[model samples]
Target chain A: MRGAVLHAPGDVRIEQLPDPAIVEPTDAIVRLSATCVCGSDLWPYRGINEVTEPTPIGHEYCGVVEEVGPGVSSVRPGQFVIGSFIASDNTCPHCRAGYQSACAHKVGMTGAQAELLRVPHADGTLVATPDDPDPELLPSLLTLSDVMGTGWFAAVAAGVRPGMTVAVVGDGAVGLLGVLSARRMGAERIIAMSRHEPRQKLATEFGATDVVPERGDDAVARIHDLTDGVGADAVLECVGTGEAMTQAIRSTRAGGGVGFVGVPHGVSIPGGRLFATMVRLHGGPAPVRRFLPDLIDATLRGEIDPGRVFDLDLPLDEVAEGYRAMDERRAIKAYLRP
Target chain B: MRGAVLHAPGDVRIEQLPDPAIVEPTDAIVRLSATCVCGSDLWPYRGINEVTEPTPIGHEYCGVVEEVGPGVSSVRPGQFVIGSFIASDNTCPHCRAGYQSACAHKVGMTGAQAELLRVPHADGTLVATPDDPDPELLPSLLTLSDVMGTGWFAAVAAGVRPGMTVAVVGDGAVGLLGVLSARRMGAERIIAMSRHEPRQKLATEFGATDVVPERGDDAVARIHDLTDGVGADAVLECVGTGEAMTQAIRSTRAGGGVGFVGVPHGVSIPGGRLFATMVRLHGGPAPVRRFLPDLIDATLRGEIDPGRVFDLDLPLDEVAEGYRAMDERRAIKAYLRP
Candidate 1:
């Protein structure tokens, strides 16, 4: 099978790799129908993160179950399903408390940029759809695996409420989806902070009431202006930079919350500022497994079409081009047809 | 009137000062029955915090109302009241949302060390008992003004459950009170980290099921061992040091919470590590004003006694000795009667 492999920073290649198989009793093998590049993938692509080997590169996908191991009972072969980036047994205490990303026995799903993939904890990790979704819904369902779930977590963690003004600090696929999540969660006004035309347009279409083209302090000031002199009730820090965190903090009200879903790099939270502002900061990994069911339902019901974030598509053989298009800022996101 | 003032580091003096009078329509003058030295007071006393002028010292006090301004209807002259360190106008949206310390109209009551104090927002800030209590309850009532409220906030913020294990990372007045608060909140097992004989004794008396006399990583290891290697479900960080914060994080289970109330200095939150550990951090200047009434009711009903934290007592004139005793670690806390 062909897969996108990261040999080193800025060195992604479409190379022949062994096809994945169900190695564990709780695992299942699937033929991926759709997959996409993630904003986090760029972390390693930019050389900021260490790439030790030829790591499999994608974590978001929707597929048909080709085969299941002995213990896989919840899902059957040939069923259409959408799973989260983090696969969990979903029976642990943490998973029972709606924090499945921290399941006692959890596994990370990667290398989805291939024709076949192995999903662990299949009985508890995969959420089967009511019916096999049409090919047009493939991209949107694929997004529920990571980006959409993460966006939903960001809104929930920030405690966004009805009639609240929510500020999103990133223009990536997750940020655009965060705007949709906040809107669906009843935020009266959504402020999308972005400079990219494609992302800004998608954000507006995703229910962003306003768009702030500025960055940093200027962006915070614009958010305040849009929020009637008071800052937003919730600020979503979808960008992991220190400046982005600071902006997110400054853009929120004195007693509001900052829900951060960004995989932080070198950013540090200043305890003093957090105290004086009296803002609650709740975030970490997206607990994606907990939201997979709801997100897949939302997508199936056509309430949210997150796949709109993708502006470019390519065959699995051109996986490297897909990465390049997203890396060079030409495409908001790139979809790979396996 | 007499008051304790910090002219500079190591220069706390009790001297005659102008008597306080109502400055606002909602203000009330209180004749202090007792005041005490706090751990935070040592920050400025030890030169860790710069002192610009002779600032009035002490925020914790139990007193009786001497006079009421025009708008003060809830509190009457000669009424015995227990007030939080912050005087807040409870009509603000933030106060309505249960964060009175972050109220739009907030007034600091640090000068409560004086013989008489002018409390602003009297109607909303002061909570009066049905009748004046016996002199024996004075110390316990005083603790409710600051330390007890702060500790309760830490426990509540950490999301302590009815049948869970909790760990407190400090052993000062607030930390000891945290043990009491966790017990009241229904934590099945409370682990208090304290090496001092006096503090450990008080912690055990306050319902700490276990006392771990370790620090930092060792303490976290002990906590994990106590909780079957899963760590505590909740951790209260009452010490504002970097090491204490790290220990609190390491002592909690994955997907747990850390409620920190100590005033942070030079401490930082590592976003990536926190995300990976799945620990949720929530804290700040506690919403003491929000909990004052409930705590005052609990104290009047004799539900708990918090004054045991004070190991020494002296007349107001000996305020200097009180600071010295706390700074020298000779006393857990000192109470001054004016």
Candidate 2:
């Protein structure tokens, strides 16, 4: 099988790799129909995250089950499915509580970028669809594995409500998807912070009531101005950085909530500021599994097309080019066919 | 009128100051029946927080209204009242949403440790108790003005559930009261972090099922060990240090919630760790107004005695000694008869 591998920072390539198989009774093998380069993947591709080995990449996919282990029950051979980045034995207390990302028995589906991917805890991890989704719905369904789920989690975590003003502080696919999630959740006003034309357009199309091409303090001020100096009722920090976090906190009205979905490294919030501001912060990984069914159904019903974020597509062999286009900001998201 | 003034970091004294009158249409003058030294007061007393001018300290008190402004309607002269550290109008959207601490017309009632104090936004800031209570209930009722309500906020913020293991990460009066609050909220296990025998005794008396004397990483590990390596389901961070924040975060189970009521200054949370752990952090100034009625009822019902945390009492003239006793940790909390 051919898969994308990161031998080192800035050194991604397509290489022949051994196909995955069910090593555990709860595992299943799936032949990926489509996958995409994630914004997080850029962390290593841009030399921000250290890559020491030829690590398998990608954790988002829409696929058809190829084989299943003896214990696998919910998923069967030839079943069409969408799985989350974090695989969980959904029966655990944590998973039962809708925090699948922190499931007691959890596994990362990073090798999904390959033609054949092994999914653990298949019975609880993979959600089978009605059928092989319409070829056009593949992109939108694929995003449910991570970006779309993450955005939905952001809106939910932030407690976005009807008649509320929500501010999204990123322009990536996830941020654009967040605009969609906030809108679907009944947000009356959405201010998408974006500088790129393509993402801005998608953000607006996704129901962003306004787009403010500003960052940091300027962005916070714009949100406050839009909300009558009360700031946003909810702010989604999709971009993880000290600046983004501060802006998110500052852009929210006192007593409002901030749902931060960015993978923060060295970021820290000053205690006094958080306490004095009276804003509630709640966010982590999106329990994508919890929302997959509804999101998938929404996609099938043509209620939302989050896949619009994907603007470029390439054969699996040209995965490198896909990464390059995304890294260079030429595409909102890049889809790869296996 | 006599008032307590911080002449310096270590020097606090009761001296005759000009009598306070209702300068604003929303203000009221209250003759303080009781006030107390708070954990936050020690911030400046300990010199961790800069003290420049001869600041008037204390922000917790129960008093008898002496005069009311024209705009005051809910409260009137001669009413015995309990007021929060923050005097809010309770008319703004934030205040109406039950976050009076973030009220649009919020006023800090610092200097409540005085013979006479000016209460702002009297219509919504002061809650009168059912006509004159027994003098014995003074201390407990005084607590509802601040510590008790603050502690309750922590429990509510942490989302303490029945049969859940909850941890209070401070031994101060607020932390001890948090134990009481958790118990009231039906938390089955309350683990209080404390090395002080007096505080441990109060915590246990207030329903702390266990006391872990360890601090920082060791403390977090101990909490996990006590909870079968899963950590507490909810954690209350009442100490504002970075170490306390870290301990609070680490001591909670994955997907658990943390409510912080301590005034944070230098504390910060690493984004990656928080995200990966999937813990929700919510806190700020205690929305005391929201819990005042319930807490007051609890006190009046004799279901709890929050005032037990106070180990010393002195006349208002001995305000200096009261501050010293609390600042030096010689007393858990000190009651001041004004």
Candidate 3:
């Protein structure tokens, strides 16, 4: 088996690695059909996040279950399935309440960028499609594991409703999908904040009614100006930066919500600002597992094309170039065929 | 007219002040039936919040409309009414969305400790009661102007639901009323966090099923123990300190909400903690105007007795004593008859 490993900042290499096996009674072996480089992956690849030692990379994945432990009941070999980046025992109080990312018995999935990946809590973490999805649906189905699910969670957390005016703070893959999620949730107007022309175009294609190229306070001003000074009814904060969070909070109308899914780097929200804005704040590492089943169904029905975010496609062996393309902003996202 | 004025920290004096007259067409002059010293009042008295000039103090009031400007419509002279501490034109987008405290033309009320108060946005801010109430209900009606309304907002913002377990941080008037509000919202178990004996007794009377006399991490641990290691479903943060906010957030389950109404002094929430906790945070100054009508009805019907928090009562000229008692923690709250 071969997998991508990060040796140091800006140093990724594809190396032959030992194949993964079912280690836990609840674990299952997945032969990944596809995987992708996540924006979060850039954090370590760009050296923004410390890379202390060589580590297995990539969490987003979708594939066929190649083997299952005797304890696994929900998913069987030969079934097409998608699981969240974080595996959960799904029956815990948090999981039952749709917050699987905080499940009592949760495990963060890693090493999915390889030919074979071991997924624990198989019965609880993996969701099988109604049947084998068409090959054309693979890209979209793959996103339900993380990005698309995160976007949907942002919209839901922000209380996006029919006839709402929603603003998305980032133009990353998740933010673009947030536009689609808000649209699906019946938001009447969506304002996408992005400085990149290509990403802005993709945002529009995903149902953004308006685009503001400004950042920070300027973006907040633009959103207010667009909404007749009422701000947006809901704002999806897809970027975890302090500036993005502030913009999202300020861009929302009082009583509106800011659903943030970005992994925060150095964000600290002043209580006074939150108090004065009177906006609802809710978000975190998205409980992607909670939305996988429905999102998979939605993708199979061709109701959405979230895979359009993958502007660069690569063979798994050339994973280094995929990381380079995304790190340099040359690709919105890089999809890899394993 | 006579009013309570803060000349400096720890110095509150009743002084002869010019009678307030309608300065705006929407203004209504009310002859105050009662005013009260708030938990927030102690901030300025204890030199926590700067009290620079000899400013007229007191914002909570309930009274009879003595005079109305020509533009006033909904309220007229001789009508008994209760308005929010913050006056607002309830027709704005924020107000229409039930966030009157964030109304476009909002005004923070002050000087209500005087015999007369000129309330702005009379038609939008004041909610007329069914009829003149008995003297016994005056204290409760006065609380609706701030404390009671704030408590109700906390419960509402926390998304309290039937059969849920709720926790309240802070043992002040607002927190006690928050316990009552959660009960009214159908919470099956109400945990009140307090160290004061009297406040603990009052909390139980207000429907607190459990009392945790711990603070900070200990309090968080106690709440989890109370809920079988599952944190409270909803938490009302009635104290604005950073510790209170942190405790409230840590004590709530993932996907649960923390509705904070305390006027924050020095609180900053780390984004990493919020992201990892996956708890929802929503609060601010209570949009009391939105709850006034319903609360007024409930008060008149004798369904709630929030005024029990006012253990000390004084005349208008003795406003200084009211401030002293509250500052020294001798009273949960102080009621003043103007």
Candidate 4:
């Protein structure tokens, strides 16, 4: 099997690797139909996150099940399936409460940017489509593995409701999808904060009712100004920086909510500020598995086109270019054919 | 008129002061029916919070309206009323959204431990009872001014619901009432974290199903053990300390909520822990005004007895002893009569 591997900062290579086999009784081998480079992947590739050793990369994926262990009863071979980046048993108390990302028996996925990927807890983690989806729906379905689901979680966590004015920070794929999610949830006014022209256009197309091309305190001021000084009813923090979190908190009205989905790099919230602001804070790594079934159905029905976030598409062998394009900000996201 | 003044740390005196008069057209002067020393008062009394100068003390009171400015329309002279420690114009967007403490026009009340107290935004700040209550209902109605309402806010912010396991941190007056609030909210199993025997007994009387006499990590461990390693479904953080906040966060199950009403002094939450724990956080100064009407009605109906927290009753001239008793933890709370 061929897979992408991160050797060092800014160095990614496509190399032939041993094919993955069912390592656990609950494991399944998925032959990738599509996979994508995630913004989080840049952490190690940029050396911001230490690269202790060469490692297989990528976690977002959707594909046909090639084989399944006897213990896996929920999904069968040859079925098209989508699963969360993090595998969860789906039976623990946390999973039962719809926080599968924090499931008692959970596993973070890696080495998924490959032709064949091994997924543990297959019965609990993988959600099969009604049938094998069309090729056009592949990209959108692939996103259910992480990005789109994360965006949906952000909106849900922020308590975005009908007639709500929602603000989304960060213009990454997740943020753009958040604009879409808020729209789907019936938010009356959706504000997208982005400095880049192309991303701003995408945000508008994804149902952003307004756009503020500002950052930090400036962005907060813009939101307040836009909301008649009441701030937004809900704000999604898609970038995990302290600045982004602070801006998100400040941009929300008192009693509103801030759903933060970004993996924090260096964020610490002062208790006094949070208390004074009186905003609800809820977020974390998204429980993508919880949304896979509905999102997959929505994609198949053409209710949303989250796949448009994939501005760059590449063949499996060009995996190195996929990482480079995203790293250079030349691509919003890069989808790969395996 | 006479009022309590904090001259310095450990120095509270009952001194003669000018009787409060309407300074704002929206103000109302009330002759206090009752006042109480609060757990927060110890912050300055014990010198944990600096006493810059002789400041008029106390912010919780229930009283009879003695005079109303021309602009005041809600409560007339001779009416019995309860108002929050923080006054707010109930019509502001924040107040309309039920966060009166963060209202557009908010005023923190002081000199409330006096014979006559002036309240701002009277029409919006004060809730008049249906009629003058029996003397037995005065204390409970008085608690609706701050402590009871704050505890109710903590239970609400934590999203306590039927059959959920709830935990209360801090055995103070506010935490004790939180147990009662949770009970009223239909939480099936209420755990009160308190080491003091008296508080534990009071907690049991207030509907606490269990009592864990532990602090910090030990308390969190006890909660986990009580919930069969799942942690509490909701936690009320009534203590405004970093350790208490951390313990509350740790004691909640993933996807649970921590409603913190503590006035945080030196507390900071690490983004990493918050993200990984996956618990929702909501808090602030209690929007007591939002709950005042209902709480007042409940007190009048004889459904709740929040005033039981006041273990010591002192005359107005003994304000020094009222402060000293609470400061020394010799009394859970002290009620004052003019």
Model 2: fraction of the reference interface contacts it also forms: 0.80
Clashes of each: 0, 4, 0, 0
In candidate 4, what are the lDDT values of residues B1-338, reduced to their tens digit? 99999999999998999998899999999999999888888899899999998999999998899999999987899999889999999999999999999999999988888898999999999999888889988888888999999999999999999999999999999999999999999999999999999999999999999999988888888999999899999999999999999999999998899999989989999998899999999999999999987888788888899999989999989989988888778899999997
Task: Name the weakest run of 10 consecutive residues (lDDT summed) in model 3 chain B.
Answer: B38-47
How good is the docking of model 4, by CAPRI class? Answer: high
Residue by residue across A99-194, what tens digits does model 1's lDDT show?
888888888888988888899999888989988998898988988888888988889888899999899999998899999999999999999999
TM-scores of the models, in the given order?
A: 0.96, 0.97, 0.99, 0.99
| Per-candidate interface DockQ score | 0.63, 0.71, 0.93, 0.90
The CAPRI quality class of candidate 3 comes to high
Better of 1 and 2 by lDDT: 2
TM-score for candidate 2, residues paired by index: 0.97
Q: Pairing residues by index, what is the TM-score of model 3?
A: 0.99
Candidate 2 off by > 4 Å: none
Ten residues in a row with the worst lDDT in model 4 chain B? B293-302
Model 4 stretches astray by more than 4 angstroms: none
lDDT of 2 by residue, B87-181 (tens): 99988878888999999889988888899899999888899988887789999999998899999999988889899999999999999999999
The residue ranges of model 1 lying beyond 4 angstroms of the native Cα positions read A228-230
**What TM value does the first chain of each candidate achieve?**
0.98, 0.99, 0.99, 0.99
Per-residue lDDT of model 2, residues A130-239, tens digit only = 88778988999999999999999999988899999999998988889999999999999999999988888889999998999988878888888888767789999998
Better of 1 and 4 by DockQ: 4
